[model samples]
Target: MRRYGPAVLLLLTGAAILRVALFTELYLRYVQAGLRPYLVGSGFLLVLLGVAAAAVGRREREPHGEHDGHHGPRIAWLLALPALALLLFPPPALGSYSAAREAEQRAAQGIGSFPALPAGDPQALTLAEFSSRAVYDSGRSLTGRTVRLTGFVTRDDDGTWYVTRLLVSCCAADATTSKVEIREADAPPADAWVTVTGIWHPKGRLGTDGAWPPVLDAASVRRVAQPANPYERR
Candidate 1:
């Protein structure tokens, strides 16, 4: 019975991760939405591993998790911490703090050759795509086109403001941000959710970072509620 305790706990923990990721918004903090299947698979695998271990241990009648006197069971118990944390508290999405800590890298690598925008008055785009266009397009595709972007607000010390979004490679731990510096608009409070419609201004460079995405000349800024999915999938 004692041998099965940890295994049961582990199985429950795995199930919890799967449930929260699937039925709730908690998964976005760690992975892109496209990874839902993989996360669920991983959670199921963990549960299976734990159940198999318990079954084998029961058949062999070996307690202490092994013949050896090592602290293997104790170490195994530590694996439950992530699940416990998830259940007790909601994981936070990457925000300005995470963005500020990382170096800025917003150069338009290949967006210069991007095909023409879809037929629309103001094309809607993810912050990453917009950043790429701003830095790489050089005013050809975006010369007069009004673009719409949605992101939380971030501020620079020099009275500059940015509309920002995080792009996650795998999780918040490895998140990179996309930002567009805004001009001629009142600086919204930090972390405010807003949609900005503006024309691209090739002249406004964001920072000392080598990847200088274009800035925006804001025509209107509309504050909105924070989105359910906070980060863009990379």
Candidate 2:
């Protein structure tokens, strides 16, 4: 039990990571979608390594009446922490708290010309994509289009409103916000997911993705159920 305890913990950790990454929305809060395969492979590898280690431990069991590291039960409580955390208190997706940091990073990246939006009258656009055009394209593409933007609410101190989405590069730790300032309509409570349909506000004062996030002259605000994926890729 002791000698193979770490292997068991490795198995559990891998299982927890795999299950969360594969089966639950919780994975969206921590990692990018593209990383799922690696997580699954890692879990399987851990389980296999643990099994092999346990097999070797059993084969090397010392003769009777001997107290050694092999026979002694090794309990690695520390190894169980990650699994325990994921199993107990799952993580929530990044919200307004992280919006500020993400916005700053995006603004600093220096906006460049972006590709044209797909052919559609009210094209559904992610916050990151919209912000890129808003900042870099200089309103060349979005000037007259009625676009649909979906994200959660983030209110500024002066009663301003925004519909925002966090962009994940590698993981949540490296996540950044790409939001749109809401003009002409009141928004829902902070962090409440909603889809806004409106035209882009011809550029705006910029500070951060959170502070400015470009501008959207929202014509309608409809609160919708949160989508399965919150963080938009790239």
Candidate 3:
């Protein structure tokens, strides 16, 4: 058992990776969809290597073969525990805690114009797009338009709640917060997914600090299940 410790660890880790990357969509919780192929390949490679290592260990234990019967460090199994945990119970996607930790930061694009929204009664828009138009669009593209946005709930100490989503360039490690202050509606629960439909409530001058986090005068807020891909791709 001691001699096969490395092989067991590798197999457990590889199975965990395959469990998420090949068997389920759970991988999206930590990485962009584009990386799924790479993850699948890596997991397959690990499993192959693990099998090879186990075969070599078995050959070493054969009669007349040079072998050390001594046990390995007991603590070495600790390295494999995380892989087991992930295989059985993967961690949830990043949520309010991640959003709250992010400092308020927006690009210095200055005031700019936005294209007219497509004709629709209530346009579905991403939180990032809504925020950008609300904060920096000189054209005020969101004004008077009924828009629908979806995100998990997050709150401030002052009781102000937001519909927040994280935008990632590649993976959750690079995620950045994008949120909107939802007004006139009761917040569902912290980290609960919700769809907010409302008209833009403009505040402050365009392209200034005051316009950040753009407010929405919500007409209706509805609870919804979390999406498969929680993070928005940048």
Candidate 4:
């Protein structure tokens, strides 16, 4: 027990830190709402359990006449519980889930309406560049212009199609999806990689399922192969 104590402590600390970082926003929100007293009560109980475990392990170490380097009961397996929970009850990917939530928020807040774009040489822009620019200033820069975007086809329940891009924090486990509607004469099948040329336009009304309204009046849709890295920028 003594020999493995340091390793177990390190593992516990690492797990706690990782969980805290992943749910930082939730923690901040809770803290602001004066619900921290409950957390404090529960935290004290965990601290007590940790102290008790350490004391019991220390006592057993002396009775066994084991050296500091002796292998103790395999407590390491206990670490798998949190990992298993994360796997079995994983968070939803940032696709329809996030989009629906955002659309609802936008509807309630009356936001997301972009200003008109000034006339310019639209031929100078690529889809990736346009999308990046729109991220910083979605309103004025992307409005009223025909642009081309290439991505895999994704569909909503209403049968409308989109060219979807996934923005990932690390891997698919934490990916978030954004999309542009395809209104071209020829729309590609779902999951097919395609390039779409479209005029940027605001969505009219919320869909029944409340997807983040798309922003393209597509002029063309042509199938292509998937890019090597399907995820968008971190």
TM-score to native of every candidate shown: 0.76, 0.79, 0.95, 0.43
lDDT (10s digit) by residue, model 1, range 1-234: 445656866786778778767678678767777788888887888789888978876775455445544225545766667777766676667777777776876543553366788888688888887777666664467778899999999888898889989887777777787888899999889888899999987764433344464588999999998887898877
RMSD of each: 4.2, 3.6, 2.1, 10.5
Q: Compared with the true structure, what per-residue lDDT tens digits does model 3 show for residues 1-234? A: 666788887888888889999999999999999999999998998899899989988877533564354656778878878888977899999999999999887876878899999999699999989999999899888879999999999999889999999999999999899999999998888999999999999999898888888999999999999999999877
* Per-residue alpha-carbon lDDT of candidate 2 for residues 51-139, written as tens digits (9 for 90 to 100): 88778867775557766644444445666777767656777788887885553556455545566777887999888877777776733
Full-model lDDT for every candidate: 0.76, 0.77, 0.90, 0.52
The candidate that achieves the highest TM-score relative to the unseen native structure = 3
Lowest-lDDT window of 10 residues in candidate 4?
102-111
| Cα-based RMSD of candidate 1 | 4.2
Per-residue lDDT value at 118 in model 1: 82
Evaluate candidate 2 by giving its C-alpha RMSD to the native, one decimal: 3.6
Model 2 residue runs over 4 Å out of place are 24-26, 57-75, 107-120, 203-212
Model 3 residue 1 CA deviation (Å) reads 0.3
Rank all candidate structures by their lDDT, best first, as comma-separated numbers. Answer: 3, 2, 1, 4
Using lDDT as the measure, the top candidate is 3
Position 114, candidate 2: lDDT: 60
User: For model 4, what is the alpha-carbon lDDT of residue 26?
Assistant: 32
